[model samples]
Target: MPEFIPLISRQTIQNRVREIGKQISRDYQGKDLILTGILKGAFMFMADLTRQIDMDHDIDFIGASSYEGTHSTGQIVFTKQPDLEYRNRDILLVEDIVDTGNTLTKIMEFIQLLNPNSVAVCTLIDKHERRKKAIPVKYACFSLEKGFIVGYGLDYDEKYRNKPEIYDLKL
Candidate 1:
């Protein structure tokens, strides 16, 4: 088995998720909200987040990919998108991690076409050193300079996603 170095603990992640959820619930208290998750990676984060929200909101999923194995291909490919009407709904785009920001730009562009009332982003992890696009992340759990993390719904070549805590995949 490949060695894994600990990064964010499971307890830390849970605390952050609950904090962010409460903030979102307060922000969108009187609006029709839709939490649209960017799939595969964001599944675990979204599930935990929504439960702590403490408000009525809808959920949906959109799948986007740019990774081929453990590396990013620098190309955005979306495999799924939400079917609900976005014209007048408040959209919270949830993502697992933001590295180059390329995939996020594409997702924002696609969602904008539906003319949602407003759209904001919430991400579990942010890699500041790898960002190539200026995408504003409204809510985030953790930020890192550089590292390959796999766990808590994040995977390395479709493995290690089931781990409860975040870890740096030692290569």
Candidate 2:
């Protein structure tokens, strides 16, 4: 079994998420905003953030993968696409983490093809230490210099996502 060390507590995460949601609500108040979460890592964050956002918005999900275990494969493969009609609407991609920017970059390319008015990114964790591409993350709940984390929708080889708080996974 892998040892899990406490990283960010659940209460701390919730407070930051609420703050981000409030900011997003203010920035997108008079526009048609769509929160498109990058699944399955983003599901938990998206759900909580949505409730904190006090404005009318739509929710959608896009599925892609770039990791085999703790390391990124440097390739993005789509598993599902958002079915909502979002042409000309403002889109905010809710991501669990921004690491190498490989998968998110590929996802942005695909999203741009849909012809939205504008696009931005929000993430629960901003891990820029290993970034290969410079992807603009507009709203980040937290930033980590380095560490392999799992919890609050982050996973390790498809495990540890169910934990309510973030953890540093030690094998």
Candidate 3:
């Protein structure tokens, strides 16, 4: 097994998720909130976050893939999208991590084409230094250092996602 070093504890993640949810509820009070979760990564975070959000919000999933064994292929091939029409709706895109910003930019651009009232981004982890585009992260739980992270919905080779806490995959 590859060595794993503890990063964020499970308790810490739960606390942060609740905080982000509260903030979102406050900011989007009385609005039609639609959360678009980027799939295969943000599924866990999306579930926890949406539960904490004390509003009647709709949830949807958008599947976009760009990783090939820990390296982004620099191309986002969208495989799935939401069925609901996003016109004039407050759309929040939830992501597991924001790294190169390429995938998120492409996803946001695609959503923008739907004529949504507004679009915002919320990420569980922000790899700020790796960003290549000026994508705004309206809400972020943690800012990760330069390293390969796994667990707590993040994975390496599709493993470690079941772990309840975040860890650094020590190579």
Candidate 4:
């Protein structure tokens, strides 16, 4: 097992989520917006953010996978597809973190084909340093160095999902 190093504390994450919610609310004011959360990893963040939004919005979930063990498979697998018709609707794709951009890139392509009025990306953690493609992340809580992070919806080998604080896997 890899040793874990403490990263973002639970309180800090909560504060950041509040700020992100404020930003989203301001940006999408008076607009009919739909939030589509990337499942498994993004569920926690999506739930907290949606509650804090204070605006009229709908929520849905989609499941996508990339990481296997400690590395990304470089391929995305969609387990559950979004159920709503996205035509002319403003869509926000929420993720737990943006790393490598492979998963998000593929997901964005899929979303675009649905013919939404507009689509944007929002992530709780932005691993910008690790991005290979120029995937635009509209709303991000924090930018972290390339590392294995867990908690706040991120996971480690399917463990640590319930941890409130984020941690890094010591290699």
TM value for model 3: 0.97
Candidate 1's TM-score reads 0.97
Over 4 Å off, model 3: none
Candidate 4, superposed: residue stretches over 4 Å from native: none
lDDT score, residue 126, model 4? 89
Off by over 4 Å in 2: none
Cα-lDDT of candidate 4: 0.89
lDDT of 2 by residue, 1-171 (tens): 789999999999999999999999999999999999998999999999999999999999999998999899887889999989879999999999999999999999999999999999999999978999999999999999999999999999889999999999999
Per-residue lDDT tens digits for candidate 3, residues 47-127, read: 999999999989999999899878889989998988888998999999999999999999999999999999999999998
Query: Which residue segments of model 1 deviate by more than 4 Å?
Result: none
Q: Which candidate number would show the highest TM-score if scored against the true structure?
A: 2
Clashing pairs in 1: none
Pairs of residues clashing in candidate 2: none
Against the hidden reference, what TM-scores do the models get? 0.97, 0.98, 0.97, 0.96
Model 2: which ten-residue window has the lowest total lDDT? 68-77
| Selected candidate, larger lDDT, 2 vs 4 | 2
Residues 1-171 of candidate 1 have per-residue lDDT tens digits of 788999999999999999999999999999999999998999999999999998999999999999987778988888997978899899999999988899999999999999999999999998877788999999989989998889999999889999999999987
